[model samples]
Target: MYSWQNNEYEADGVTPKLSEAKRGPADPRLTQSNEDQLNVLLGAVVNYDKVIGDHTFNILAGVNRETIRNDNFSAFRRFFISNDIDYMFAGGDAEKDNGGAAWERARLNYFGRANYNYKGKYIAELLWRVDGSYMFPKDTRYGFFPGAMLGWVVSEEDFWKDNVPFVNYFKIRASYGQMGNDNVYYNDELQEYQYFSTYGFGTYIINDAMVKSLMESRVPNKFITWEVANNYNLGFDFQFMDGKFNAEIDLFKNSRESILWQRNASIPQSTGMSLPAENIGKVDNSGFDVSLGYRETFGELGFNVAINGGYAKNKIIFWDEAPGAPEWQKSTGRAINAGLYYNYAGVFRDQAEIDANTIDYSDITGNLRPGDMKYEDYDGDGKITPNDRVRRDMNNVPTFQGGINFGFNYKNFDLAILFQGATGAEQRVGTDESGAIGNFLLDFYENRWTLDNPSSEYPRITDRSDQYYSNNNTYWLRSSNYLRLKNVELGYNFSTTWLEKTGISSARIFLSGQNLLTWSKNKVLDPESSNALGHYYPQARIINSGIMVSF
Candidate 1:
C-alpha cells in the first residue's frame, strides 16, 4: 500500500521533510501472510451383502486415521525504497518484528454399520463409532457413540392396496442418534492442546548478553470430556394422486450437554486464577420442518410448485445463575439469546402527562422530558429503577421462516420464481454508536411528536438530546417480519434436432435476477439484518444473462 498526504508545509510552499534523509512524499507499506498445511489420511472399508428368499441383509465396517499440521507467518514494514519493489526487504526502515506460528492435530476413528430388511415392508439399521483425539487425556482420550433407526412402509401392505385404491403410498420414519463436538470447550481439558505445558519466553540481561527465560503460559484443567448432543426425530412421508402430489413433515428435538463454559459466572472476581473451561451448562432445541409439492404435465406443458417452512426454539436448560437475583434476572429455563428491554407505553405526550404519571425514569437516565419515551415500572416502587428493568421476550432469532418455489416448462421455454420470508423476530433500529445521536434517522424525524403533532406515533426530535431514548425499550424494537421475491429466471432451450447440423447437441440461454423485491414492516434496512448494531448493507439485487452450450 502507498499513500501521500499533503502536509501543512507542503500546502504552504515549504519543504515537508523534517529530516535530511527523509524519504519521498509517498508513504509505502507492505504486508505478507502465508499459511501452509499438510494432511495425511488412511482408511479401510469392508462390506458384506446377502439375500435369501424374501429377506435381505448388509453390513459395513471401516476405520480411519488422520493427521494435520499447519504453519503461518506474517510480516509488515513501511518506507519502501521503490513502489516497484513491494516486498518487505525493500523497505528502508522496519516498522515491527515479523512473527510466525506452527500447530498440529491428529484423530483416529473406527466405525461399523449393519442393516436388514424383510422384502419391501420393513427396514432397520444399527451403527456405532469409536473416536480418539489428542485433545483429551490418554486414559480418557477415546469416546464411543452408537445409534439406530427404523422405518416401515405402511401403504405397501397387501390389505392397503385392496382397501384404498386411490391412495398411492405413505410411510412413517423415526430415528434417535448421538454426536459429540470436539471443538466445544465444554471440558476443562478442552481443544487442540492449548493447555499443554505451553511456555512464553521472557528477556533478561546476563553478562551483557541478552538471555531468554521461560514461564508457563496458563493453568490447564485435567478433567475434560467431549460435549455431547442427543437428537430424536419422527416424521412421515406420503404421496397421492398417482405421485402428482407429495408432502413430508418431520419433528425433531436436540439436547446438548456438557457444554463448555469459560468460567463460572457466579465465582467471585477476587478468586479468579487463569480460569479454564468447564462443562457447566445444558441447552435444548426443538423444531419441525414441512414440505409440500405438486407436479404434473398437462399435455405438452409441465409444471411444479413446492413450498417449505420450518421453525425452531431453544432454551437454557441449566446454568449457574446468581444466588439472590429475581426470577426475571435469571437465565435458568429461559429462551436462549433473549434481549434486555423495557416495556413501552408509547411516547410521553406532554408535561401534563409526565407530571400525572407515577413512572419516573430520571434517576436511571437523565430527567425525562415530554416528547421522550415512557417505560413501565415492573416493581411499582413509585419510581423507575434497575428493579423496574425487565426482559422482553423479543429475540432477533426468527421462530418462523420458509420459502416457496415454482417453475414451469412450455415447449422450449421455461420460467421459475422463488419467494422467501420470516416472522416472529424483532429488529432493533435507530441510534448510532454514541448514545447521543449524530445524524437523525429519517423515520424518527418524519413521525416525531411535537407540540402541534401531539398524536404522533414516534417521539420528538429530542431523541438525540436525552439518554431516555438511548436505553433499550420497545421504541427501538420493530417487527422484522417480511416476505421477499428471492429469485426469478427465464430460459429457452434450443431444439437438439435444429442444432444437429451445427454440431451442437444442446444449448440454453437464460436471464436471472436475485433479491428483486421485498415486503416488510421494517424498511430502514432489509429485515433479514435489521437488528444489526450499525448501518447494515441491504441485500443486493443481481441480474445476469448467460448461455450454456454442450457438444
Candidate 2:
C-alpha cells in the first residue's frame, strides 16, 4: 500500500480586524503554509493447513516493510496595502520570513508461526520474529524474539463429559513471549535517530554582524538500541449452564529492560555539556483481567450483560540514582515518574498549639501562626526543610479499570447501555497561586480554615506569596476515582413484512447519548483530565437521533 497527502492554507489577518483584536491595531498580514506527506507499506503472507485422522497441522509466515516521509514550508509577510489584496506578493518583503523542514524513516520485519493439535483436545504453538529499526546503528539494529504456548481442553474428554453434565466447555492455556520496542519519546516529543550527533540552526552576533550558523544540539551514542520486554501469561476460559454463562480470567507479568534515558540525576551540571542517552533502566509489572457474561431469552425478549475489569501495577527495578541520595528521595523501588511532596500533617488550629510544638518550621515560614498548614518532619530532623520531602506512589494513570455493557431486545425494539469506572490514581486539583489568580474551588472556600471554623482539611485564606500556600504538599492531592455513564442507545427496527412493500430490505431509527453523567470526588474538574490545573477542556456530553436504511 502507498499513500500521499497534501495540505495548503492561506489567511488574511486584516479581514477580521473590524472588531478590536488582542494586540491593538492590526498590521494587515498575509500567511501561507504547504505540507506534503508520503507513506508506503509492503508485506506478504503464506498459510498452510492439513488434517489427517485426529492430528492437525497449521503453518504461517510473513514479512513486512514500512517507510514514511514528510515535508512542510510556511511563509508570512506584514504591512499589506489592503485586505482586498491578501496575497503574499502584495505585502512588503522587509518584514517577511520563511521556513521549511523534511524528515524520513523506514523499518523492516520477518516473522513466522506453526501450530499442532491432537483430536482438538490438546494444542501447542511456536513463533519467532526479527525486527530492524532505522534509529539505531547498523550493527545493533536487528533484534530476535521468540515465543511458545500450550493448552488443554479437559471438557472434551469422554470421562469429564460424563461426570460434568451441567458444564459445557472449559479450556486452560499458558504462554510466554518476548518483544522489542523501537519507538521512543522524551518530554512528549518523538526522538529520531538518537544514535547520531545532531546540529540545529541558530543565529549569532559575530563581530557585531548577525550571521546564521549551525550549533551542536546532541551527543552521539553508538550503542543505543531497541528496548526489550519479556511477558508471561496464564489464563482460562469456561462456559456453563448450557452456554448461558461464560467467563475468562488471565494473570500476566512483564519485565522490561534497556529503557532509554539520560542519567541527569547522576551527572553533574558543572560538566557544561549535553550527555548522550543510554539504555540502563529496568521495570516490572504484574496484572490480572477478568470478564463475565450472561445471556438469556424469555419468549420474544432477550438480553445480555457483560462485565470486564483489569488491575495492573508496576515498580522501577533499576534506574540512575545519585550517589549518597536519601532513600525517601530515590526513584528506584517506586512507581515510574513518582512525585515528591511534603507530607501534610494538619492545619494549625490555634496559636497556643503552634507555640507548644517542638519541630522548628522557621525554615519554611518565618511567621508561623494559626490557620496555617503544617508538615511532618519525615527525616526525624528538628526542622522542616527540603530533606523532609517524601515520595508518593500515585499519578494520573489508573491502576484499576473496568466497564459494564448491557443490551436487550424485545420484539422489534432494542436498548443498550454502557458504564465505565477507574480507581487507584490521584491528581493535584487545587490552585497553585491563590488570591492573585483565584481560590482553588468553591467548596474549598466554604470550608476554609478560620478562627471560628478551624477546619483541619483546609488552610486559611492566603495569597500567592504566602509560604504555607506555595509548598508542594499532599494537601493538594485528590483521588481521581470516578464512574461514568459512557453511552446509551435505543432503537426500533422495521418489520420484514412492512419493509417488503416499500422495496427496502431493512430499516431502523435510533437515539443515542454520550458522556451523560459522572460521579467523582473532584467536582471542580473532570477526574480523567491529566491537566487538573484547568488548562484542558472537559469532556463534552452529546445527544442525537438518526435513521438507517438498506435497499
Candidate 3:
C-alpha cells in the first residue's frame, strides 16, 4: 500500500482602512506541508482438513513480513511583497523555516494453528507464533509465543437438549495467550533501533565564529528487549427464551513483564549522560466484562435493550525505587500514573488553632492564617516537607466504564438512544480567586470560608498571584464520574408502495444528536477530560438531519 498527503495554508493580515497608521505591518505568511507513506506486506499460507470416523482435524501455517516507510516535509515564510499575491515566492527571504524527517520500520512473523473436534460437541485448539522486530539487539530481536483454547457446546449435546429445551444455546470456553511489545519511547519521542548509539551535528560558537560540532545524541543499551504479556481468559455465552435473551461474561488476568522504562531512580542525573531505557518493570491487571441483552416483538412494534460494562484494576508488581525512599512514596504496588499529594486535613477555623498547632508548615504555605488549608504530616515529623506527600489513586484513568443502548422499530419508524458513563476517576478544579479571569463561580463564592460563613469545605479567597493556598491535595480532587446522553436518532422509512410510486428502491430521513446532555458532580469542567487540571476543550454537541434515497 502507498499513500500521500499535502496541506497548504496562506494568510494575509488585514488592516482597517481608517486604522492603518495605528497597526503595524500585515506580516503575510504561507505554509506548505506534505507527507508520504509506503507499506508492504508479504504472506503465504497452507491449510489441511480431514474427517476420520467421529473425529475431525484442521491444521494451518503461515509466514508474514511487513515494512513501512514514512516521510514528512514542511516549509513556512512571512513578509510578502504584496498581500494581493499569496505565493511563497512573493515573500522576503528572512524568517524562512523548513523541516523534514523520514523513518522506516519492519516486522516479520511465523505462525501456525491446529484444531480437533469430537462429534461436534467438544473442541480444542493450539496456536504458536514467532515475532521478530528491529527495535532490539540481534540476539533478542525475536520472541516466541504460544496459546491454547478448549470449549464445550452444551446445546449440541443430546442430554442438554432433553433436560432444558427452553435454554436454546450455551457455550463455555477458556484460553491462554502470550504477546510481545517493542513500542517504547524516551523524552516523548519514539526510540527506534534503541540498541545502537546515535549522534547529531549542531552549531556552536568558537573563536568568535560559528562552528559545526558532532556530538553523541543517544547512548545505547544492548540488553534492552521486548516486553511480554501473559494473558488468561475464561468466558461463557448463553441464550434463552428462543433467542430473546442473551448474555456474555468474561474474566481476564494479564501479567506484563520486562516493561521498557528508564532507570531514573537507580541512576543519578549527575552521571551527565542520557541513559537508554531498560526492560525491568512489571505489572498485573485483572478484570471482568459482562453484557446482557433482550429483544421482543409485539404485533408491529419491535424493540431491543442492551447493556454492557467492564471493570479493570492494575498494580505495579515491580519498579525501581529510589534508595531509602519512604514506603508511602513508592510507586510499586500502586496503580499506574498515581500521583503523590499532601493529605488534606481541613482548613484552620481560627487563629487560635494555628497557634496551638506544633507541625511546621512555614516551608510550604509561607505562614498559617485563619481559613487557610491544612495538611497532614505523613512522616509524623514536626515539619511538613515533600517527604510528607503520599501516593494517591485519584487520576483520570477510570476503573469502571459502561454504556446502555436502546432501540425500537414501529412499522416504518425507528428510534435509537445510547447512554454512556464512567466512574472511579478524578480531576482537580482550577479557580482564579482574585477575579482576574472573571468573577468566581456562585457556588464557590457563596460557600467560601469567611468570618461570617466559616465554611470548612472551601478556603478564603486570595490574590491569584499569591501561591499561598496552592497545594496539591485531596481538597482539590473531585470525582470525575459522569453519565451522558451519547447519541440519539430517529428515522422514518417510506413504505414499498410509496417508494415504487416515486420510482425509488428505498427512501428514508433521519434526525440525530450526539453528546446532548451530561450529569456530573464536577460542575466546573467536563469530567471526561484527562488533564489533572481540567483545562482542555470540552466535547462538542451536535444535531444533524438528513435524507437518503436510492434509485
Candidate 4:
C-alpha cells in the first residue's frame, strides 16, 4: 500500500500610486490588491495477488482526491464634498471568493494470466483485465480488456532433428486488445464561475463575472462515455547464424471511437455561449515496426549493432459540425496539428496584367501589381479572398523515424554509441495570424524588404498601407521537414574482477553526453523544437561522468 498528500498557498498585493500621491509615504487609499490559490491533493493505491499451479492472478485499486480555493480583494478611494460646505468622507471595499472540492476518480483493476508449457516445444498464454474509472457514468464505468497470444517453435519439432545443424529457433505470435484513456477535466455536473467587483464610497457592487458557459443538449445518450481504442498486432521472431543475428517485425492497427472533442455549437445570444464539449469524432492510426540486431566476436574483441525503425499514419475517420455550416467548415480530414495556408503562385509580372485580369486581391492587402504571389482562385470567381486559402501540399505525418546503435567490447572494457533522427513533417515558419500580439524576435526578421533590396523575398517595410500584401508571402513560409541527431550517449564499463578484489561484487565508471550534435537544413531555429515554430525555452546540452558500485 502507498499513500501521498500535498498542499500549497500563495498571496500577493500591489499599491502603485501610493508612493507618488505624496512627497512622504504615499496614502494607502489608491491601490489594487489580490490573494489567490490554495490547493491540496491526496491519493492511495493497494494491491492483492494470488498464485496457482501454472498461473498468476492480481488485483489493484486506487483512489485520488483534490481541492482548491481562490480569493481576491480590491478597493478604490474617492472624496465627496457636501453642498452645505461640510466635507464628508466615505469608502467602499469589494471582495470575491471561490472554492471547489471533488472526491472522484477511484479506479479498480483485476488482472489474470495463465502460462503453460508442453514439453517446452509449444507455448501459450492468456490474459485479461477489468478496469474502471470514476470519470465515466456509473453504468459504463467498467469494461473488460482481454488479450491472448500463442507461440510455436518450429525447430523443436521432430522434423527438424536431422536439420539441427542448420536450424536454430523460429517463433510466430499474434495479439489483440482494448485500452482506454480518461483525460477529462473538471466536474461535469455543475457550472463554475469567477466573480469580480469594484469598491466605491459606501458601496461595493458586482462589476463582472466569467463562467464556463457550455451549450448542453437534452438528447442525453452516453454523454460521459469512455474513449475506447482497439488494437491488433501480428509478428514473427527469428534467430539464426549461430545466434549471432536476430530480427523481429511487427504490424499493428489501432481504431479509436467516441473521442471527446470541443465541438463548435451555435448558442443563442440569450445564453451568451459559443462552444461545448461533446463526443463527436473518431480517429484511426496504423503503423509497422522492424528491428534487427547482430553480434560477433573476433579473438579478444567483440562487436554488436542494432537498428530499429517505425512509421505511423493517422486520419480522422468521422466528425460532425454544427448545422447550417459550409462544407469546408464540416470537413475534418486533417489532424489538429495540420498546417493551413494559401497555395503560392509565382509573382505577378506587372500592373497591366493585374488590371487586365478581373482578379480580386482582397486576401492580398497593400500594394497591387506583378511580382507578388498569385494564389489559385478556388471559387473561380476571378478574385482571391479568405475562401481561396486551402490546405497546402505538404506532409501531415512523419515519413519515417528510427535509430541505430553500435557497441564494442574488449577484455573488461565496453563502449557504446547511438544515432537517432526524424524526417518528413511540415511546419509553419512565420506568424500568419495578425490579431495576436506578443514576442516576435525568434521569427526570421533578417530579410525585411528595403530600398536597397527592393526585390527581396519579403515585401517592402512600408507602413500599414500595404500591410495586407506584406502579411502573406512565401518568404515567411518555410519547409519544417528536417533530420536531426536526437540524442547520443557513450559509456565504458570496468571489469567486475577488479572490484571483487576490493570486497565489492561489481563496480564501473562511465561518461556520457546528450544532445551533442545536429545536422539539418532548417535555418531559423532548432528544427526539432515543435510543430508550431515559435520562441520557447532553449533546450540544454548535458554531459556527465558517474560511478556505480555493488557490495
Tell me the tens digit of each residue's lDDT in model 3 across 139-236: 99999999999999989989999999999989999999998999987678887777887777788999999788999876889988889999999999
RMSD of each: 6.0, 7.8, 7.4, 11.1
lDDT (Cα, tens digit) per residue for candidate 4, span 1-551: 22222222223333222221324333223444556766666666666665565545455555545555566665444332323332113332332222333332256656566665555566666667676665556777776777776667777787775666454677777777777766544245431110102111222334574444333333233455566788888887877788888888888889888775544444444664433345566887788898999999999899999999998877677765446544443345655444445556645455565676567786566567444556667667788776665643334356578888888888767777778777766554545322223334333345443445434244433232235544343444555456444455445555666766889887777777777777766676666666443555765677878888788
Full-model lDDT for every candidate: 0.79, 0.86, 0.85, 0.59
Model 1 residue 376 lDDT?
A: 75
Task: Give lDDT tens digits, candidate 2, residues 485-506.
Answer: 9999999999989999999999
Worst 10 residues of 2 by lDDT: 1-10
Q: How displaced is residue 491 in candidate 3, in Å?
A: 5.0
TM-scores of all predicted structures = 0.80, 0.83, 0.81, 0.67
Worst 10 residues of 3 by lDDT: 1-10
Q: Which predicted model would earn the best TM-score?
A: 2
- Cα error of candidate 1 at position 136, Å: 2.4
TM-score of 3: 0.81
Of the two candidates 2 and 3, the one with more favorable TM-score, higher being better, is 2
Counting clashing residue pairs in each candidate, in order, gives 1, 0, 0, 5
